[model samples]
Target chain A: MEKKKTTIILFSGDYDKAMAAYIIANGAAAYDHEVTIFHTFWGLNALRKDENIEVKKGFMEKMFAKMMPRGADKMGLSKMHFAGMGPKMIKDVMKKHNAVPLPQLIEMAQEQDIKLVACTMTMDLLGLKEVELLDNIEYAGVAAYLADAEDGNVNLFI
Target chain B: MEKKKTTIILFSGDYDKAMAAYIIANGAAAYDHEVTIFHTFWGLNALRKDENIEVKKGFMEKMFAKMMPRGADKMGLSKMHFAGMGPKMIKDVMKKHNAVPLPQLIEMAQEQDIKLVACTMTMDLLGLKEVELLDNIEYAGVAAYLADAEDGNVNLFI
Candidate 1:
């Protein structure tokens, strides 16, 4: 029997949004589906390593790196961002509810062997070096994404 | 041969996000795919009528209605929303490029026979009434969305 395919385009940088993407990806993986999460634009922040990697970059790239969150744990909430308080509040609630944090959710996705692909085009635009991201993830462009999505049972742009 | 299906869960209320959703939906429709855009959460704002409707509502519902944009044209941008200036700049650029605005894209989707569905669960939660939305759209719940999406070639959450 053919396995069902799920492809998600993670395009938002918000912590809550990334959590949603990872949660969905993990769920699909648990269901024995082949899942691919293609991180693009601000979504690339989720894949960034917490420690900065010193690399040569253009002025715009440096500016973007400084402005964007270092990793998933540093990202903010999509709604009620209340001067960075919303993320803290949500994290507390998640802890109380025994909900998995975004970072752990991402780890679980990787453990499940759900393929993670970073958008190479956006990486160049944002000045993110390959060494700056988490290890073991593939890097590709839109053509690769479209090839996966065109036959996917669940193709989501999140 | 069975027609290819595309289903989108329009989850963001941002003007640019909604525009992206509509553009993809329109493109799928043009490609002769059966398409559905299931509006939920903030996505409901795009389906709202610009004119105010005097509907009875609880305090929370009224507050939600008041805070959300009345229609697609009034929604803010997801990125670079510099004190509401980003949307204006985008509109200017879109005008210069002769790009269709979000409202027209919705109209075009209708003309192409694409299905526009409002998530009834979220609509009730948000206290939006039927009269407050555009005519000729269907109201449904998650089951209906999943029914379409489980067989969909492209299922997006935007």
Candidate 2:
């Protein structure tokens, strides 16, 4: 039997959605599938540092970094977000359901040796610096994703 | 050659995320893959009728039905949804990009014979009636989804 491949395009920045992405990725890895998560655009927010990353950037880049969520913990809810309370509410619900937090899920995915890729084009467009992201991750462009996706047994854009 | 299978659990009701789900389903169907979209929980909102459904329900169910989005057209944005203007802004951007609207994408998926399954448990929990949904959709439980997913080449939760 050959090893199956799974490639995910993480495109949403919302906390709940990011949780879903990680849950699926982790599940796939558990099923013995080689999984790759390609983070792009808003999805890059999941990889950001929680604290202000001291990286030298241009004016617009600095502004973008300031405006966007610092990391997975800082992401907002997708909908029904009543004055920033919805995320807290959902987190409570998740805890009740024994679901792990999004940040921990990301760590688990890494521990499971799932390949995490950050989109370089999105980084350029959004002015995100490599120093601002989590360590031990791959960075590449769309072609790189397509190359993997074209042969992959499973491909998803979340 | 064997036909590939893809199953998507459409778990979010937000307009933009629903659009992404439909886009992926439509694309997969175009590629001649057997695709199944299992709409559950909040996802049932995407299948609702724009007008009052007029289904008799318990107090809580009625309240839920009233609170959720009526249909694809009435869905809120997943993020940055400020005073309902975010959806409008995104609609404009979609138009500029020549992206089809959510409702149209749903129609196209139906036309392409993609399997659209409304989760029966979710429907019961949310007080959604079949009469309130679009025509020609399947109703099933988690077993149905798991059956299709067991041999699926790709599985997604959006």
Candidate 3:
């Protein structure tokens, strides 16, 4: 029998939203399902690092990288974001709940061998370079995601 | 023949995200799928009206309703929100793309008889009252949503 397949399109880069996406992906993987998370657009921000890294890119792309949040810890909240404090409050709540932070969640997802594919189109559009992202991830476009989703029993956009 | 079920959990109340959710729900309904949008938490904000209406609620509830955006039109963007102006820019982009606004897309969903259910638990948490929300919608808890999702061919959270 074919293994149960779950394909998720993680489209939000907000800290809380990214947490939800990773939580679902980890849950599916725990159920013995083949899971794929296609990160696109702002979702790519979750993969960025806080420290500046040299990557050959145009002026605009480099500027985009500088402007956006470096990683999950630096991301803003989707709502109640009173400046940057909303994310801090939510992080405090998460710690209280014993929920792992977004970075840790991403590490767990990788440990589970869930396929994390960065959308190349978004990378080009946002001017994100591979050196800025964490290791152990694949790169693909919408066509690749569609091909995987077409065969999957479950498909989600988040 | 039974229609395929598509149940979406509208967890984010961001204007663009709500637009995406409604667009998907409308698309699924057009394809003859039984579509249900279970609005919960911040998602409930999309169903609110812009005008203030007197509703019988506790002090905390009323305060919540007052602080949050009344309707879909008043919602801010999930990201890049420059003091609430980011939504305006996105609306401009949507207009250029000839995409309908969130309110119109919602009307379209209702016209198609797509099931729009509000999460009671979230209502209690957020202090939203039915009087402040758009009419002709169902109210239910997670049990009801779970029942719908159990048979759903596609389930999404956004």
For model 3 the local lDDT of residue B86 reads 91
Flag clash pairs in model 3: none
Model 3 whole-model lDDT (C-alpha atoms): 0.83
DockQ of each candidate's interface versus the true one?
A: 0.25, 0.19, 0.21
After superposition, which runs of candidate 2 have C-alpha atoms over 4 Å from their true positions? B1-6, B11-35, B47-66, B70-158
Error of 2 at B72 (Å): 6.5
lDDT of each: 0.88, 0.84, 0.83
Q: Fraction of true inter-chain Cα contacts (below 8 Å) kept per model?
A: 0.49, 0.14, 0.29
Candidate 2 chain A worst ten-residue window by lDDT? A89-98
Task: Single out the weakest 10-residue window by summed lDDT for candidate 3 chain B.
Answer: B58-67
Q: Which is the leading candidate under TM-score? A: 2
Q: Sort by DockQ, best first: what order?
A: 1, 3, 2
Deviation (Å) of A63 in candidate 1: 11
Q: Which residue pairs collide in model 1, if any?
A: none
Candidate 1 chain A lowest-lDDT run of ten: A58-67
What TM-score number comes out for model 2?
Answer: 0.68
Q: Is candidate 1 or candidate 2 better by lDDT?
A: 1
